[model samples]
Each structure stands twice: as structure tokens, then as C-alpha cells.
Target chain A: MTPKVSRFLRDAAPATPCLVVDVDRVAENYGRLKAAMPLARIYYAVKANPAAPILGRLVDMQSCFDAASLEEVRLCLDAGARPEDISFGNTVKKESAIQAAYAAGVRMFAFDSEPELRKLARSAPGAKVYCRILVGNVGAEWPLSKKFGCEVEMARDLMVMARDLGLDPYGISFHVGSQQTRTAAYEAAIARVAMLFTDLKDAGINLRMANLGGGYPVRYRAEVPEIDAFGAAIMGAMVEHFGNALPEILIEPGRFIVGDAGVLSAEVVLVSRKEQDDPVRWVYLDIGRFGGLAETEGEAIKYAFRTPHDGGAEGPVTIAGPTCDSTDTLYEKSNYRLPLALDCGDRVELLSTGAYVTTYASQGFNGFAPLAEHYI
Target chain B: MTPKVSRFLRDAAPATPCLVVDVDRVAENYGRLKAAMPLARIYYAVKANPAAPILGRLVDMQSCFDAASLEEVRLCLDAGARPEDISFGNTVKKESAIQAAYAAGVRMFAFDSEPELRKLARSAPGAKVYCRILVGNVGAEWPLSKKFGCEVEMARDLMVMARDLGLDPYGISFHVGSQQTRTAAYEAAIARVAMLFTDLKDAGINLRMANLGGGYPVRYRAEVPEIDAFGAAIMGAMVEHFGNALPEILIEPGRFIVGDAGVLSAEVVLVSRKEQDDPVRWVYLDIGRFGGLAETEGEAIKYAFRTPHDGGAEGPVTIAGPTCDSTDTLYEKSNYRLPLALDCGDRVELLSTGAYVTTYASQGFNGFAPLAEHYI
Candidate 1:
């Protein structure tokens, strides 16, 4: 067991399994992305972390909002994002959801099929449409291309149908995939969308925007392409294909906006020996599946068990959570040093959990309390 | 794409991401276990799905609640579980938490340490203690024995300390591990606990219960053991080892109680081609890292993706959720078939999601909503 330890942020008091967003880091991330995509309008994906305070700050940063559901739109709209400044990007939407989006004043939406276009025409009269396409992925194993994006043939049909309905289907959009490891995917995707743009223009539709759907990969475990270099490659492709005819650019980067800005802080509860012939030990933390890194089951990143403090680093101890469930383990092993002895009430901080952490918390146990926000 | 279809208990109405438990299935599950272990006292591990109504139902099943925290104790109390019926099973606990558990009227608690004994004595002096033992795991890659249970040698010492403190240390407890695949582990654990009974008696401490702990596996996939048979083996071991001296038995069963009873119904929003040169497709559902399934990164469990209305099942599709993050995928690849083509707004049900589903959901895009509870 590691000895008694403390976290710098919780030296005063501790809140277990809560997310703390470093507001300064978030602003810096937004600033860096905004600077690189000077010609393209950036929209923060609210699905990452939609805290009202975070939403308000992003709005202040002049970033538009991207929502996936009616409830998401409502939350962003309530947080004071202009209705038109919001983009309802979920392609497979309900009729009532489409009508609600229309009533909520969402002007721009993405469509991946002829049925989607037809439904939009019936529900929202003359909504501006962007034909979302399944431009072949570069190398990332993203599921979006198969799940939501329309094929090239279907994209053409949807675009023509939008024109027939007298709706200004003024854009071409394709998300390469999230956490894209290579920049070539974006380049290839942009080239494909460019071809679609030319085809749409030949059909007498004046496109106004080229939406490079957001899947700007954050370098989670490994190095990814730089935003500037990747953007430059895509922009160069847009200029080569459409020249002056290329529309204004829009990108919907979700994780790139806020992923690294948040951290989940938990406390150590007990340190005990593992079962069997193995000589391993364990340090139980307060945060488990209910915390931000819940997707890792009990363990998220390999380094999730990596503790920052050397003094608190104890012997090789597997970490578990406070949940009574058998699967409530946090780490199978630890690489970092832990305190030689840790009693109850010690803290462990889970790093780099800002993007999808707090928003995915289950409120089923003890009324869900929002993580306390501290802006520095 | 399979033609639009439907399935049992779901309609055209969109089902939310997290799994919904059939109250009937839950009641039946409890009834089956009760009938099998007629002499054993079941302690429902509330960490699986600690909603108030779920706890209330368990109370009616006559099962006591096993809580890890003071808050969980309060939750069981709020759901009308008598304090005496609540067991604080967390080995390493806070002083305030101990007081809270005591105040909440919990009488039985698990003790893991020499220091913890003094703390529990100062806070919950009247509470009965269960000396948790580190009886090495049966056959698990990772076990809870690493984090909570006391060493076998320490268990003897702690029992002696409990006696010196004038506290009625009721029994010894040990959890094999979650999703434990070995039945022999239970037999071995019972043998160790039986041995400990003699050790504690030699120390002049009379104990009356043996909590073999809860790591009873659930059939998340087709490969798990039958619950009925496993129950028989465990009971047989208890009778064999303890003979007439078998203390009142207690077991904490978490996922095994509710995992199979729940299904997460989601909407299939988009289906597109995987961009690779090879022909592959992606089926995106409206679920993600924080939605219905919480531990995609840990263990790989097959999700039975079915469309509502009997949509004819299609090719092997990789299923993903709507979160813009790359890691938000649900199933890497599946051989699922539906009745018809799934269009926009078509529903997909992810089965066997009852255990760690909403308990880990964070309201990322929209806030968490309550699940519907229907009586059998």
C-alpha cells in the first residue's frame, strides 16, 4: 500500500471521481486551432463536454456549436448560442426531431441520403443542406464513414434531389474519422469532396461552404499530424480542385477542442494483496466505472494507472475502485512508484479526461453531481 | 442495409442508449437464486445499478444491500432498506464515511486493516465486523483480492483485534474476482475461510458467518457458466467445508443479478462504406463511450445489434456510437442479422447491457434521464 498522499488541487478538500477542466489550457487549445484554420470557421463539438460554463466559454471564443440530439441543441441554445450558429449534424434523425430542429431555428444541417433530403424538405421547407459523403478513409479505423456518411453515388443523388426541391444544398462535407493518425486521409477526403463540389456546380447549384467534417484526431497515445500541416494540405487540395470556386471552409473538431484540457481526480481508499499465487498488490481508488474514464471499463489508458507523484508511488499495486462490483478494477498493474504505505483518504488524479469525461457520467447512483468547475 | 424492422419490447419510438431492465426479469432472477440458495442470505451489490427503484425491488426480494460507500448506504436507506439490512463492505473507509454508515444504521461492515479497526471502533463502535481475508484468487487474470481483502495472516490478526475491541466480528469474507470463470475457486475459497474459522476460534474470537464474497459470473456472452449449476457447486462446497459449523452465509452478487436482464436500445443513424479499398460497411448507433456500455476498452463483449420491426439482417457490420470521438465505438465487428433494411430513425438494440450501463453514463451531450420501471 502507498502511504498517505495529497493532490495539489485538492489540498483543501477532495471530491472523488470529478472532472476539472483547466480553462486556460482549453482557451489555448481553441486559440491554436483558430489560428491555424483562419479561413475556416471552427465549431466546438458539444458532445465532448457540454457543461454550461464550458459552453459559454466556447461561445465567447467565437466558436459555433455542433449538436447531435434535440436535447443537445436545447442545452446549447439555452446556453446562449445563436440558433443559426448551431449545426444539427446527426444524419439519421427522427421526423419529430427534424421538425424540432427546424422550430429551434437550425438553418444548416447535414444529409447523407435522398430520404434524408426528402424528409428535410417536408419538415423544414427550405433548410440549407450539406451532402455528407463517405469519402474513403485514409488509414484510421473510424466507424463514422460506414455508419453515417453517404456513398459517392448516393451523395450525388442527394445533392440533385436537394436542387430539385429548390433547396440550396450549398455544401459538401465528409469526416475522415476520429483520432486519424495520418494527415493523408484529410487530404484524400478533401480531394473527393472537391470533386463533388465541381459536380454540384456543373448541376447549376452554387455551393457556399465546404464542410470538412470534424474528426481531427487528438494525439492520445501517439503522435498525430499537426493541425496546421494537415489543414494546409487540405486547403491546397481545395485550391487546386475548385480554385476561386471553392466555398468557405468549416471543420467540426470535437476532441481537438477540449480533450486534453480536463482531468479526473480520484482518491485512494485501500491497498491490499491480489489473489492467487501472484505476488501483486492493489491500490483501490475512489473513482471507478462511474468516473470519466468509464469506457476503459475499469482501466482506460495504460498510463491511467501512472501516478504523477513519486512519494505516493508505492510497490506494484493493481488499482480498484470503490464500486462493489467485481469488475470495478481501475488498473491491472502500475508502472509508477506508489507510497510504501497508503491508508484510506489518499487521492489519485486521472489525467487527460476533459473531453468525454463528465458528460457521460451515469446519474443513477446517488443523484449525479456535476464536477466542480475551476477556471485558472 | 437491412430493411426497416423491429424487435421485442421496442417500437418505432427511439429507445435511449443505456440498457433498460425488465422488472419482471429482475424479479424472476432474484426468485430463482432465492429458491436455489434457500439457506443463504443474499446481499444485493447496489454498485451494479443503484437506482432507488432497483434497490427497492431488491429489498422486496428480501435481499440485504452491500454498499461500498456511505453514500451507497444512504441510497439503500433512501430506498427503504433497513440500516441493519445494509452492510458496509468497503475494507478501507473514511472516518466520516464510517460515521455516516453508522448514522445510516448499517450494523455490519467489512474490516481490512489494523488501523481501520481503530477507526471503525471510534466511529461505528456498535457495528459488527466482517474480517475480509486475502485468500488468493481461484483462477482470474486479475482479482479483487489485490485491492480490498486482508492477507490471510492479517485476517487472523484483525479478528483477534476485533475481539480485543469487544466488537462482534461476525465472519470472514473474500471475493474471488468479477466474471470469475473457475468454480474450483469457490471451493478453494470456502476451504480457506473454513480454516480461518479455526484460526479465529483459537484466538478466542467466535464468528458466526462466512461471506465467500461475490464474483459470480454473468453470461455476457455464450461462453459463461449456467447460474443454476454454479449455485449448486458453491452450496455444496459450503456444506462440505463448514459442515454443521457453517456460519450464516452472505454473498455479494452484483452484475450476475442484473446484467442479462437489461438491453440498450439505440437508433441506427447512418450506414456508410468503410473507406478502405476492401469492401466493408459501418453501422453507427446512437450510443457511445458514455452511453449504454461503459467498458469498451477493457473486455470485448459481443453486442447483439438488432433493428426494430424485424428488419432483415445484413452483412457483418462494425457498430459504433454517435459520439464524434474515435474511441466511442461499441462493437468492432459483428455477425448480426436483422429483419429489414435500417433507414434513418431505425432502432438497434444492444443486448446484455444491464450491469455497467447507465451506472457509468455521464451527461455529455444531454443530461441522463430515468429508465422506465414496470412491475412484473
Candidate 2:
């Protein structure tokens, strides 16, 4: 936990299963990212944590936004972000959303298919549109599947068609994947996008932007390359691929900007064993999958935990959430270990949970209230 | 879709993505279950769908309740269910929740461990408690893992410990699984629990109740055995084990009570292919996993669809929700096929989604509003 969040937890003593975010840490991370990649414009991915405080802080920092839906676009606007500073980033959108965003003066949008392009042409006339191209996600923890982007050849045709349909063929974007650990993934995607930029230029569509979509890594239970390494690797790839004619660079980072800036405080409700002699204890927390530690699905995102008994004698544990459903069980195969002294009513903080915990929570699954959020 | 739901959808064209439930169908389901298992008391599982209308109608039928949390117990009480008619059924619960329910006149609870039993002893004092045991979950679509229950020996010990702590060791309980497809699954679990029932009786605890927890399946893309099969198998096992001195039988049916009583109608947001000639089309809808089709996490619980062009020429397809996250992609490997004529803005209904849909929804992931609900 950041010092501010630690102080808040110590002083305020909020209820269990609540997230406390340090807004100052968010600003610091934003500054560090800006320092690492000065040439690229940052568009805070609002889907990560769209709490008003986070949005207002990013808006005050003059950071742009990447909105996944029309409601998110309005959230940014409500936070005093200019419509031009917000990009409608989702490729699959309702035509009504497109018309609404266009009327709201949001000119920039993203699309990948002919139908979506047609919707854009009809709804948001002459809007600057970026085509999301499919990229390999070999090294990412949460590899985003082929749900959003189109094949490279299809994107090439779509960009050409964009200009024909009277929309500005603004750019090409690709996501290596979310929580991408390997810089080589970004480099590979950048090379593929550069070749596409050349192909589009030869086809008489002068694209002026390249959106390297969000996949920046955050430290959880393991180490990841620093933001400086990603910065250097990305710039090196750009220089190698495009020489001095690099297009305007854009990075839509949801996880990186605020991922490590908050901590989720939960209480241990029960600590027991399935068998009397079983070595491993089952630790049940007050919150669960439905309460929004959703990244724990399949034990994909291994979040580090800090218990009140940290540094004491430890033993292997199988962690689960408080819901009655079996799917709410987390960290069974991952071999989680907690301090031996950890018991019911003891507070534990899950570190680096700032990004995706709040909005991902269910309305009130199993009649448990939604996870609360506090921004200090 | 049921004729009632179909008529409501056509006559009162609500928003694109909303759940329209036929409360009359819920009443009919209650009657059917009563007919199928006349010897067993039906405790309506409120976690499935705790809407006021469903609860009120079930209350009218003189149904008891199996609540997963204190808020659910309160929901039952608010719906005119007496506290004596409700069971705090979750094995894992907070002491505060137990105290709250006890204060609110709840007397029965479930536990699988000594620690939880101790909490009940302290918070609920003389409350009657049931111990849940681990049982194999074969032939279950959503196999509830070994997260909630305990070993037979452990449950036996925990019940004794409950009696020692001044609480009533009322009975034993076990869940075969959710969406359980086979009658044999219940028979196998009954055999396991029956042996323990004899063991506990020899130990001087005359437990009076047996909770066969909910797992009843609903027909989705495939058919399941009729409720009569489960009822017969369960009765046969009980009679074979207990002879002439059968205990009071209780079965919690969540999905069976309401799963087929509702329909979720969503608008197709976009329909496209990764490649121009690709055979599989990716159909995006306004509702997705985060929007409460969470049963599709591992492509389990395959819900049937009703499209406007249902009988038209069909082609292979993958379905996804409107959220921008790749995890929002619902069905990719389930061999889902939709009509070739299905296109953007077309409305489709997912049938048998009455249970576990509304409350499981996120707090508006990706800025899309939560799936609306209407009961007629």
C-alpha cells in the first residue's frame, strides 16, 4: 500500500473489502510515465477505475482519455475534459453512441469492420477514425483475445475505405495484450503497424497517427520491466521502423497509470482446513469474485497480499471469497501462503489493485454489497 | 421464450438490453416442483434471483428460503417470509452478519468448520445449525468445487463441537452442484450423507433435518432430466438409508425455481468477421459476462437464443458482450451458430436466464448501464 493509503487505513479504519486509492500516487505515476515516454500522449483508459476523483485528477493533469462507452465519454466530459481530448476507443459501438459522441463534439473514434465503418460514416460524419489491427499476445499475462481487432490485411482495406467514405483515415492501433511483460511484443506490433502505415501511404491515404494501445505491465507478485525500459524499447522500435517520419504516438494505458496506486483492504472471515490433518488452510475473505477481485478468475492475476501477521511463521493456504458459489474460490492451484497467525477479523491488504477493482464489482451478488471505494 | 415473456416483449417494447420475467411462470415452476417432490420441503434459493416480485410470489406459495447472506435473509423477511421460514444457508459468513440475522429472529444457519461453528455459537447462541459435507460433483455443468464444504469426518466433528458450544446441531447438508444434470449425483451424495447420519446418530446427536442443497438444472442449449427423476432418486436413497424413520427432507432449488421463468433481450451491437471470407462471425450484443451472463465464464451453462431470423440460414458464430475488455467475449468455442441474416440492431432473446442474471451484473463495466429488469 502507498503511504497515503496506509495512513488512511490506519486512521480512518474503513470497512473491510474497500479500495483506498492514493490520488497523489496516481499523479506521480502519470509524471513518471510522461518522463519515460515524453513523445507519446497519454489517454487514461477510464474503464480501469472511473471514479470521479481519478477522472478529475487525470483531467487536472491535462491527460487525454480513452472511453470504452458513451457513458464513459460523458464521465470524462463531466470531469471537465474537452470532447476533443476524449477518444471513443471501442470498435464495437452502437450507431446511436456514435451519433451521440459526434454531437458531443468527439471527433476521434476507433473501428475495425466494414459495418462499424459504415456506422461511423453515417453517424459521425468525417470523424477521424483509427483501425485496430490484430497483434500477437505471446508474452502477456492477460492476453486479450481476437475480440476487438481485425486482421492486418483487413485493416489495410478498412483504412483505404475510410478515406473513400469521407472520414479521415487517422491512424492504426494494436494491443499486444493487457499486462504485457515483454517489450519485444510492443516492438513486434510496432514493426507490423509501421509496414501497414507504409502500405496505406502508398495507397494515397496519409495516416498521421499510430495508437499503441494499452498493455503496459504493473508489478504484482512478480517483477516486470520498468516504465523506462518500455519507453526505450518502444522508441527504439519506432526509430528502427519509421526513421524520422514517426506519426503522432498515442498510448491508452488503463492499468499502468493507476494499477499500483491503490490497495484493497479485506478482512479474513474464516481460516479452516477441509481435513483435520490437512496442512494447507483455506482462508476465506469477506470479499470475493462477485465483489470484484475479478482478475483472480482462473488465478491469472496473482496479487500480492500483506497480512497483519506478515513476517510471522507462514504456511500454505488456499484462498477463497465469501460468496457461496464455487467459482468464487480463488488461488487454489496458485499455492498461496499466509502467515500462521492470520485468523478471522484480521485485516489484509491486497497490493497493486487500484486499476480494475471498483467498476468490475457486481451490483450485489449473493446480497453482499458492492465493494466500496475511497480516494485520498 | 415463454408466451408470456414473448407477449410482454412485443406489447411493451422495453429498452434493448433488459430482463423481462413472467412472474406467473415462476408460480407455475413452484407448483411443478411441489408436485415432483411432495415429500420434500422447497426452500427457494434467493441467491439465484432475489427480485421482490419473485420473492413475494414464492412467499405466497408458502415456500421457505435458503439465503446466502444477511441481506438476502432481510429480503426474505421484507417479502413477508417469516424468519422461521428462512435458512441462512451459506457455509461461510461473517460473525456480524450472523449476529444481525440472529437479532432479526433468524434461528437456523449452516456451517462446515469448527471456526464457523464457534462464530455461530457466540453470535447466534442457541441457533440450530447444519453442517455441509464435501461430495463428488460429477455430471454437473457448474461443478461447485470443494470450496464451501468439508470432509465427512470434519463435518462430524464440527457438529459435535457445535453441540458442545451450546448450539443445536440440527442436521447435515451437501450440494451436488449447480446446474446438476444427473439424478445419480444426488443419489451418490445422499449415500455419503446417509452414512454420516448413522455415524452421528450413534454418537448421540439425533439430527432432525437434511438439506439437499440446490443444483437443479434448467434446459438451455441442451435438455436435462425432468425434476421427477431427481425427486425419485432422492426419495429412493432416503428410504433405502433411513428405512421407516426418515428425517424431514429439504431441497433448495434456485435455478429450477426461476431459471426458465425469464428472458433476457439484447440488441446486436455489431456483427463482423476477422477476415472478409472467414466463416465465423463475431456477434456483439448489448449484454455480456460482466452484464450478468457470468455463467458463460468457461463456456459452461450454455443459454439458448431466440433471434428474429431464427429459422433462416444459419452460420457458425462467436458471441460477445458490448464491453471493450476481451474477457467480455462470451462464447468462442461453444460452437454457437446464429442466422446468416442476423445483423446490427437486431434484437435477440436469451432464454432461461431468470435466475443469476440481474444481481450478478457489474456496476456498469465499460460504462454500459447495468442490464435492466422488468417483471410482468
Candidate-wise lDDT, in order: 0.69, 0.92
Give a tens-digit lDDT track for model 2, residues A1-376.
7778888999999998899999999999999999999999999999999989999999999999999999999999999999999999999999999999999999999998999999999999899999999999999998999998999999999999999999999999999988999989899999999999899889998889999999899999999999998999999999999999989999999899899998999999999999999999999999878898998998989999999888999999999999888899879999789999999999999999998888889998999889988999
Report how large a share of the reference interface contacts model 1 reproduces: 0.34
Residue range with the least summed lDDT across 10 consecutive positions in model 1 chain A: A1-10
TM-score, each model?
0.80, 0.99
Interface RMSD of 1: 4.7
TM-score, cand. 1: 0.80
Tens-digit lDDT track of model 2 for B66-148 = 99999999999999999999999998888999999999999999998888998999999999999999988998999988898
TM-score of 2: 0.99
